[model samples]
Target: MASEQMPPVVTLHEEYGCGAREIGERVAASLGVEYVGRAMKSETIDEIAGDADEGGFVERFLRSFTPIPSHDANIAWALEAHADHEVADQNNRYLADLAQDGAVIHGRAGAHVLADRPATLHVKLIAPLSTRITRAATEAGITPERARHRQAREDRVRTDFCRRLYRWDPRENDRFDLVVNTASFTPEQAADLIVTTYRLHFPV
Candidate 1:
């Protein structure tokens, strides 16, 4: 018999506090695939950029862009750009390796990184800013104001990261094959939609 082909990779991008980790886990479990999330990607990137000096390519490139604690707008922009590029490259490689086995990857620009891959389904999850703030506040046992501040900061970072690295605005629905509004759909519902969509595109 011929070898079984791998399933299509499901890549999910979500706004801060959108429950991506929970939904991603559900999708991975429902599909019996690996769940690759930002935590894992961060660990991988730290390892990749390890104690190597500024002489190492990755280290040198990363160090060259460190933002100075000054009010220089141009310097800050360059710093953010460089940091975004470093992250994008590391994440792209990590996702590329995971793509071989087929996995549900959330965040770390998995969708953008695997955009050209035929066997990848890109999904985006979002919710109203207020809804996200409330959910985050409840989850973290914090004040709504604090949650709102945190969410805003995270959203800004992610927006800049994607714009700098991919020249794409992740909030735009056109970037994803499927966009789920978490306020309207439960995590389970979102996961089911993603699984169903992936299967529709690449049936057994």
Candidate 2:
């Protein structure tokens, strides 16, 4: 008999305040696998375009493609459509390379990047806006009003980025193998659920 095949990549797409980072970290730790998410995505951008400031290349890239006003109120940043496409291409390449390690990738269009791969498992996490706002407020040490405002801004930016780059909404349930509402479950529970699901598909 042949040895069992290793599991495919696990990709997580989530709203800004949905606790994906926490849950993904837990899942990666439990599985003894690597966790690749925003930080990795940022590093990829810096590698491709060179560093500049705090936000740097990735920040500009996201802002350029954002359909609405960006976080920076004073400086309006915009890139040509082709430039946006190039950045997105670089992101896809980076994600593909990372997924080869059979890791849990937490966002930046990872699901779409690995969509064609046979072993890839894509998940999406969502929550009620109020719940997300409270979580964001608690995490950031900010008031609920402030957190709510920030959440709305982030939602617009992320939604617009996906729409402009991938021609699809990340919130669409059809794109994911599993959709969990973080409002109903703690991060630990969410992580356990994901791990259980993965084991069901790819047993050790």
Candidate 3:
């Protein structure tokens, strides 16, 4: 394959509790490139996990278990709340900046946000709940049940944010070019596949 055809950008969105982060890292390593996550780019998670008065704070503060009437309403609320972080400008800027470079970007709607870019290979990483629970427990050094709860909390918050802001479920299938199940494949195998695909589709 020629370099011009190679994909210059790659993005992965994973379900919470999935080993997406680790796998993203490995894939970037295999490709000799960068790996980035939304957490790395924004402090929203830290603020939300802490005592900040971020947007949707009051509502989410009440209880994550409270279900919105529809996923779209929740995504709208999350976008509205995103202003609290004062990161919207930064987010757009960074998304534009990312177009100048390629990396293993983990979250913060990197795929959808950077859709204008022509060379990105979008991927979604998913795994069974059991795989996620075990991965989180082993990595976080917590019990399985506790890990499950924590994973669910994190997943819910992120999903809620996406639903409210984009009217799109993070788990939806349309946003990705390739979807990998980590439960069935080793991270290295996943990385190998991504790299191979990159070489095939993105000869740049």
> Regarding TM-score, does 2 or 3 come out ahead?
2
**lDDT for each residue of candidate 1 in 1-204, tens digit (9 for 90 to 100):** 111356668988888778888899999998888998763332343354455432242333344455335468997767666676666677678888998878998876777778877767889888998888888778778889867766755666556656666787887877588888999988899889889998887677
Candidate 1's TM-score = 0.75
Tell me the spans in candidate 3 whose CA falls farther than 4 Å from its real position.
1-7, 40-86
Candidate 2 residues 13-84, lDDT tens each?
A: 888678888899998888777988764332244354443533234455554444434456443334345556
What overall lDDT, based on C-alpha atoms, would model 1 receive against the true structure? 0.73
Best model per TM-score: 2
Q: What is the lDDT of candidate 2?
A: 0.73
Assess every candidate by TM-score: 0.75, 0.77, 0.75
Please report, in order, the local distance difference test score of every candidate based on alpha carbons. Answer: 0.73, 0.73, 0.68
Clashing pairs in 1: none
Better of 2 and 3 by lDDT: 2
Clashes of each: 0, 0, 13
Which ten contiguous residues of candidate 2 have the minimum total lDDT? Answer: 39-48
* Full candidate order by lDDT, most accurate first: 1, 2, 3
Residues 68-145, model 3: lDDT tens digits: 444587785774465433444556578667656567788877767766566677888888888889987897777898
lDDT for 70 (candidate 3) = 44
